[model samples]
Target: MPLALDVLAQVPTRREAVREEYLRRVIPQFTGHSIGEVQWSTAHGDFHWANLAGPDLLVLDWEDWGTAPVGFDAATLYIYALQAPKTAARVRRSLAHILDDPAARVAELLVCAQVLQAADRTSFYATLAEPVRCHLQTLASRSA
Candidate 1:
């Protein structure tokens, strides 16, 4: 995932749901903005540990590359890291700039919704349920 803000400039977002319809049709309310209202940028459609090759710092899994909300890649990693709180914390700390961005919050919620939806297909993301709910509450509180 692209943690640095500069990484956004280095890549172009291919046309995909990350920037278009998912949030709107799938999740109507995210953070304080509608999906279409959020900011957009180039993103690795899928980003997880399995795709990363350390030492050399290579990234794999470019299957769903597209334009996504800014900081979404970081948000995706953070979501995937939920089962390992420490790793999630590390992701947050490493991508503080993106995670702290207003737009990133929406992206985070979108990922959360995605996880929740995935739970229906399989229990793989079940561990993230409570955390994602709590996160939504926090985000809602901030908006309120």
Candidate 2:
């Protein structure tokens, strides 16, 4: 896990206690789940608007593609939604339409997922985001 931790350190700064507490609360939910197994391979890892095409989506940045936990992509999309409120609402609506989980639970899980993603700072905002820093503060407050 040192490699992953190293990757995390490269990203934005957040309160250490908050981040750790968040991880502690969420990690147990997925304990014993296979997280490192690759199930599908895609040509693009980060498929946001920057690389998307009209009507037809194109995957770019293949470097991050690998066998990862299920819903990993969805989590990434949710993070993107956080960065863009309209998109996030749309994503939430879509999830509500299909997912059986309660909205509050889903939201909590999404936060956890975002924290997990942040744990790997190989992306652009890894080193430059204040929101995530605030998130860390929130996590710390919750733990306290």
Against the true structure, whose TM-score is highest? 1
TM-score of each: 0.83, 0.41
Give a tens-digit lDDT track for model 1, residues 62-102.
77777777777788888888788898899889888778888
Best-matching candidate per lDDT: 1
Residue 119 lDDT (model 1): 69
Estimate, for each residue in 1-144, the C-alpha lDDT of model 2 and write its tens digit: 332212332344222212234434454442211122222212123434465555654545555543322233444454555656688668656644222232222333434455445655756555423444454455446435
Worst 10 residues of 1 by lDDT: 27-36
User: Global CA lDDT of candidate 1, please?
Assistant: 0.72
TM-score of 2: 0.41
Q: Which stretches of candidate 1 lie over 4 Å from their true place?
A: 1-5, 17-19, 29-36
Give lDDT per model, in order: 0.72, 0.41
